[model samples]
Target: MSWTDERIEQLRSMWEKGLTASQIADELGGVSRNAVIGKAHRLGLKSRPSPVKATDAKLAKPAKSPAAPKPAAAPPRAAVPAAPRPAAPPPKPEPRPAVAAPPTPDGAAPVPKPDAPRIVSIGPGGFIRQGPGDQQAPIPPAPPRRLVPAKPSPEIADKTSLLDLNDRICRWPMGHPGEPDFHFCGEAVNPGFPYCVEHCGRAYQAQLPRGTRRPPPPPPFGGPRVR
Candidate 1:
């Protein structure tokens, strides 16, 4: 609604009296609170404090009185002394008497003492002992062993060269290559072998019993020597 001169005058009077915009709007019909506030602002009417803020200030609780300083703690009291106890009596000593042996009758024979025990040692070197009247003879060194001569290799009269080699012919190599005598045994090969019966005998031999076998020779000082 338009702000007529009378309505503007009434709004000014209510605002100056500290009445809210809503209250002024109710008094002047056909106008809203916003319109009244706008009219007041144009007229340069003084602004009023908010009613909500005023009510909050009135209802706010007052600051609590600084808690009375707690009374100072009471001072500690002095401790009392305890009575002294009596000492325990000393313990009595135990008795231990000396023992004596009975005297022997006349013409009686003296008792004999036992002989010292002998110490026996057993290991890779063999059994040995040390004691009086327990002497052991020195062991004799083993005798030198004689080696049996090896059988001479069979001579292949009809030697087979590499070109003439076949499944049915002996393949045993003889004499080093690059030599005029180098050749393979020409004899018929044994059933399942690539060499003749004589060559196969040389190729495979029965293993000797463990007791009759010789120990391997020691390696050369610098390293192993090629044969």
Candidate 2:
């Protein structure tokens, strides 16, 4: 059976007893959690009220009673004999006649063979469930996407790289240590002769005179390396 009013009430009672949604769903074999939540919300189902103690119930009684009181002092009256009233007639009995069962429709009594693929609720649990044939709620379609390309920002492009951010495009110490003009014992800190702060060079060398070092060599690329 679907989650009818009675089933919702049962769920409310179970909730009052502290059973969780998953527990309820498990007991139901496979009722959807959303279904339970929706039913509870729509029906305003809530945990049962706490039981009131007998003493508390008595304490809540009104101080003033609504019943009228009888006179305290009363005068005596002469005794008189009275005749007894006649007995009331016996109550009329209800006529319960034999009733016959309605005739079954033709072919309905054959108990047509059960279909092979049909699913059945095997557990004896009290929870309600939806039919396997019931259509599931549809999944929503994906949202439309923007197709705009990312444009590079001129402000960022114009920002200069810090001195320490040398990406090492220079092959200044062209040949390795042992080659000619390798300058194994090299030292030109700013020009980063041997070890360009990366310590990639194994040897060090002293700097050349003012007009030395091949006029700071052209940037391998025809473009300028700095502004």
Candidate 3:
């Protein structure tokens, strides 16, 4: 609610009389305590500190106790001379031996041979070799491996290549179209036949009368089956 002139004067009077925000709000109808507080703050109105209640004053003042006796004065400390520190132990001697002086340049140092591949203790009789070029101990060269040509199987090796065939491919469609697992037969077509040997068996069942057309044998294991 808007703070009318009458409400503003009433709020100021109530605040000066030590009335809380809630009490002021109750006095002025249609106004909340927060609204009253906000208007009071905007009007630069100051609130008086709350006076101590009767019960609070009684609890705040603690009862007095009897005076305690004073403690006796302590005696003065005696001065004592500090004992002399023990002499530091002698320095420890080094454990390592002194290095020997190098010989004069007139006596040249022995040169070390270049490092190469060396064989050590291959078999019994202590056959240790210093290097491959060492003539005294010789190792024989390994024999070359002979490779045999692999024979092709009649079933797979005889089949026509998919690359050599025309775009016809196998006519046998696997599952119905619009199906989740729909797929078509992709094998090369047999000569004079729409379906491959595998699909041929699936496309046409065995004849009822004496069979004139003998269907080709089913494809090998793991080959596609007729859906």
Maximum-TM-score candidate: 1
Q: What is the Å distance of residue 21 in model 3 from its true position?
A: 2.0
Model 2, 30-80: lDDT tens digits are: 577667667666778674333446568778886986889877977889889
TM-score of 3: 0.25
Report the Cα RMSD per candidate.
24.1, 45.1, 24.2
Give the Å error, residue 204, model 3.
99
For model 2, what is the alpha-carbon lDDT of residue 221?
Answer: 78
Q: Is candidate 2 or candidate 3 better by lDDT?
A: 3
- Against the true structure, what is each candidate's TM-score? 0.31, 0.19, 0.25
Each model's lDDT = 0.80, 0.57, 0.72
Clashes (backbone N, CA, C under 3 Å), per candidate, total: 0, 5, 0
- TM-score order of candidates, top first: 1, 3, 2
Query: What's model 3's lDDT at 59?
Result: 91
| Model 3 whole-model lDDT (C-alpha atoms) | 0.72
Span of ten consecutive residues with least summed lDDT in model 2: 156-165
Q: On a 0 to 100 scale, what is the lDDT of residue 222 in model 2? A: 89
lDDT, candidate 1, 28-144, per-residue tens: 988888888888888998888889898899889687788888899999989989788888989988764533434458756555434445566665678565455566787898998
In lDDT terms, which candidate is top?
Answer: 1
**Candidate 3 — worst ten consecutive residues by lDDT sum?**
155-164
